[model samples]
Target: MTSNMKTQVDDQMVLLSQYYPGIYDQLIPEQGEVVKPRRRRKKNKADGNSSMMRKRKLSDEQVNLLEQNFGNEHKLESERKDRLASELGLDPRQVAVWFQNRRARWKSKKLEEEYSKLKSQHDSTVLEKCQLESEILKLKEQLSEAEKQINSLVERSDGISSTSPCSSFSMEAMEPHFLGGFGMEGLENVFCLPENNYIHGSLDWMNI
Candidate 1:
């Protein structure tokens, strides 16, 4: 077949496949036939091969211009995109895509910063809680020690009271002074006499 005629046939088949998509698959040759599948061009930029569709890196001048504009506003209007594209000698689509990617990166960075701040705050709070708990334990220990000391003092007071000289003096030791044969008169003489007179009188009474 002539190249021109083959091209015409291929074009006709492509048109037919578009009109009837279900029959396109059924029309494949069977057995050992070596048929190359038609290459379909992508209608959308995102559908292209990754290597081919990858965005070109901006030059320093282009980047500086884009960064200046980005500092003012993350989203660019269509007119602004076109103007920037003209000034930087780039396509409007490239400017729009750069802004979209930049905004996404900005949001991610902001989230990361917020997470770090919150984590720091949480750590500080936990440390403060631990310190307070330790302080409470120390206070409890001091209170326990104070109570032990008070108990010890009370026990010592009890021991001192038990061994006091006044506590050891019995009523039996004084009974003779009140119940002697001289009776009430002897008790009055014992109270009124001087030390010397009392000693002489006691000696004389003993002789009697």
Candidate 2:
């Protein structure tokens, strides 16, 4: 061993010697001796895990009764745990552990139910929004078609108006009444042409 390592071991020995009667003054470690304690510790940890996994499971009747009790109350009071243990032919600790595991499963079930409800609501909202957007797009398409026809009729009216000096219709004067947001009905209201003009589709012509 190095001088620093020897000094550390000497200090440890001196400290332990007061409590431990058998202490070695001269120390020498074999090749594998340093690794032995870690191997023993690892083996003991494995044995502890194996023992925990070996716990006995309860019977069907015991599980059903435990489920009924859990449905009635989530918590296991000491008095109730003892009574349940006696009735189910189990230890109180076993009953407590079962209830603890059952409560965890129950909480997960409630969270799943809540998530499903919220997801359904979100889907419904998305569907409604799509429907509204489709209707708005359809209206916009209809309005664009109507505007094209109106422009055609006004151009025809302008030729007839120039020959007859009494006619008051012009594209410039009609523009102030035209609004994009107000659909085809507003277009009909804006165009107050005389009965001598040609009639278009369903545009209820009357004097302004």
Best by lDDT: 2
Task: Put down candidate 2 lDDT per residue, 10-128, tens digits, no spaces.
Answer: 87666555442232323446776752221111234446566664546678999999999998999999999999999988889989999999999999999999999999999999999
- Compose the digit string of candidate 1's lDDT tens values, residues 1-208: 9999999998877755664345446677768886554555435674656757555678899999999999999889999999999999888998999999999999999999999999999999999999977875664455455545545655676678977654553324444453254323222212223346432322342233
Give stretches of model 2 more than 4 Å off: 1-55, 158-208
**lDDT values for all models:** 0.69, 0.70
Q: Which residue pairs come into collision in candidate 1?
A: none
Best by TM-score: 2
Q: After superposition on all CA atoms, what RMSD does each candidate show versus the true structure?
A: 28.1, 14.9
TM-scores for all candidates: the values are 0.48, 0.51
TM-score, cand. 2: 0.51
Clashing pairs in 2: none
